[model samples]
Target: MKIAPNSRVLITGGASGLGLALVLQFVERGARVLATDVHEEIPDSLRGLEGVSYLTLNVTQDVDWAKARDWVTETWDGLDYLFNNAGVAAGGRIELSEMDQWQWIVDINLLGVARGCRTFTPLMKEQGSGHIINTASAAGLIHPPRMTEYVAVKAGVVAISESLFHELKPYGVKVSVICPTFFKTNLTESLRGKDEQANKSAAKLIDKAKLSADTIAARVIRGIEKDRHIILTDRDGKVAYAAKRFARPLYYSMMKKASFQMAKKD
Candidate 1:
C-alpha cells in the first residue's frame, strides 16, 4: 500500500520512539496523521506539526480504540493505515518472572496489537484498502534468553501478523510485521525485571546498539511502499532472522552465547 498524499493514518504510542518517528515521516510525506498515546500531552516536537493531530488512546482498552475509530471516521471518513505500535518491555528467566509481569507485557504488547487490528479492520475492509503494521521484535524471530515474557508476546504478534496477511489480502488490506532489533527508545523506561542488575545490564546493551528509531521508521515507510510483509531494520536482526530460517543450530548457539554474556554482565 502506497502512503500517498492525503492518506489518512492512525498510529498508537505516538508520543515517543518509533511511533513518533512514524508520525513525523507520514506527515512529511503528505499523509494526514492522527497520532495517539496514553500521555495526556503530545510530545513537544510534534505539537505544531501540520497535517498531524494528537489523540489520547490507550491501545489496551477497547473503549479507547472505539473513541479513536470514531474520531477518524468522523474526521476523515476512513483510515488508510493503522500502526499498532504501543508496547512494553520485560526481562527475566521464564521460571523466575512474576505472573503479573507476564500479564502486563502480554496485555500491552500482544493483546494491544490484537485490539488495534480488531478495531480498525472493519473500517479498512469497508474502505476496501488499507495497511496494518504491527511492531514485533527481532526477539520474536530469534528468542533471547531471560526476556521470556517479551519474547513470547512478540512471537505472538509475528504469528498473528502472518496469519492476518493471508486473511486480509482478499479484502485489499495488507498486514506487515516489523521485527526490529534494539534501538534508542523509551522502551527501557518501561522495562520490567525481577533483578535490577540484570535490567541495567540489558539497558546498557541496548544503548550500545547504533540503530535509531528514525532509521527504523524510515525503513518501515519503504517497506510499506513496497508492500513487504516482514520488515527488518538492522543488520543483526536481519542476520538473526536468516540464521533462524536457514541455520537453526547456529542461531540457537549464537543466542545462547549472547544470553551467557548478558548473564555474566549482570
Candidate 2:
C-alpha cells in the first residue's frame, strides 16, 4: 500500500483521463508499471518508458484480461496493485435510455471491474500482499435524476468494492473504491445517452470542474499509502457525501429542486 520503489502495478484504461494520470503518477513514484488500454497503439504519455510498459487490454474481454494476467504473472511474477479504472459514461431517464446502452455501460462499468477482481484476486491472494483500486462515481452515492444507467452501474461498483474489501481482507489483500465527482478528464468522451440535454449538462459540469485528474490521482496515491478505503476524491464530493449522511431531508429537497430546475431548463 506504500507504493514502494519497484512496486509492480497494472492500471486499466491508461490511454487517457484519470487512468493516464494514475499511470504517470505511479511511474513517477518508482513503481514498475504496466499501463493497459483498449487502444492498439500506446499513448504518447507512456511511450518509451523505462519502468513502465504498455499492453492492450479491453477490460470487458476475457482474452484481453487473460493476456494481462499472463503478463503480470510471467514478466513481473507478482502484482502490488491492480487498478480497475476503466469505465464509460451514460445518462438518461430509465425510459429514455435504450436497453443496449444499459447493457453496454453495465458490461464495461460494473462487470468489467468484477472481471478484473476475478482474474487477479487469486494472484493477489497467493502473493499475500496486494491492493485493488476501483473507480466508482459520486453519482453512485447521490442517485441524481437523469442518470439511471450510469448511477445503477456505478452504485453496483461501490457495492462490489465494499464486498471485495471484506472478502479479500482475510486473504491479505486490500480493496479501495474511489467515488470522485466531475473532474477535468475525457471520461465523457465515451458518454452515451438518449437525452442530449443530460449529456450536454454532464459534459458542461465536467468542463467547469476545478479539480484536475492529476490532483485527484495525487490524492488517491496518498489515500492508498495510508490504506484508506472509500476515497471521495474531491472537496465537492466529500462535502456532498457529508451532507447526504448528516442531513438527508435537506439533501433530498435540494436534489429534487435541482432536478426540476434542470428539467425546466431542458
Candidate 3:
C-alpha cells in the first residue's frame, strides 16, 4: 500500500483540519489527490494546488459517495487510497443527548466511514491494491465524559477499521485507524452540545493540545507507509490508549476524575 507518485487518492473532509493537511502532503509527494468536503467552495489554500482537485461530497449521503466513486473511476480509472476523514464533533452526557443529535453524529462520523468503505472497497479489490485510512479519535480509544456522542461514533469507526483490517489484509488492501488527540482544527467550531460551559471547557482542552493537524498528518502518512493498523498521534493519546488496554480501572478512574473536574469548571 505504498503511496507512490501518481497514486490516486481520495480524501473526505479535505477542506480543513487533518484532511487539508493530508491533501497538502499527498499533493507534495506527487500523488494525484481528490479532496472532497461538504462545502460548495474549495478552501483558498487548496484552490490552486497542483495534482489536487476539490470536489463537493457529503459523506453521509449514498448518492454523494456514488458520485465520488464514479469520479475516481472516470478521472483516474481507479483509486489507491481512500481516507475516511470527514467527521463532526458533538458533546453532552448520554442521558442528556437528544436522538436527533445522535442520528446526526452517527450519520456523519460512523456511517460515513461505512459508506465510503462500501463504495470504494470493490474498486480496491478489483485493482488488487488499495488502502483505507479512517480517522477515529483518542476519545474512541479512551472514554472521556461530556463527549458521549462523539466518542461512541469514533469508537464505531475504530471497530469498523479493525474488522476491515483483518478482512482486507489477504486481499492486498490495508486498513488503518487513526486515533488522535486534539489539534489546531475547526472541529471545535462544529461542536454541538447543550451545555455551554462544558463546551467552553472542551474548547479550552483543545486549545491546550500540543499537536497540530500537520503533525497528525505526518503520523498518518508514516502509518500508511508502515501499514500500521492503529495510529496514535499525540503522546497523551498513546499513553491513554496503553492505560485503557492494560489498566482499565485506572483509566476509568482518571476519566471520571477529569469529568468531575470539567463539571466543576462548568
Q: Pick the TM-score winner.
A: 2
- Model 3, 149: alpha-carbon shift in Å? 0.5
- List model 1 lDDT by residue over 158-264, tens digit each: 99999999999999999999999989888889988786765886799779878889999999999888889999888989988899999999988997898788678
lDDT of 2 at 44: 85
Report lDDT (Cα) of residue 41, candidate 2: 90
lDDT for model 2: 0.90
lDDT of 3 by residue, 1-266 (tens): 45699989999999889999999889878999999998888878689899999889999899999999999999999988899999988887666678898999999999999999999999998888899999999888888877788889999999999999999888888899999988888888888878777678678878887888998898899888887999988788889989999999999899889878877864
lDDT of residue 179 for candidate 3: 92
For candidate 1, list the clashing residue pairs, or say none: none
Stretches of model 3 off by over 4 angstroms after superposition: none
lDDT of 2 at 53: 91
RMSD in order of candidates: 1.4, 1.0, 1.4
Worst 10 residues of 1 by lDDT: 193-202
Candidate achieving higher TM-score, 1 or 2? 2
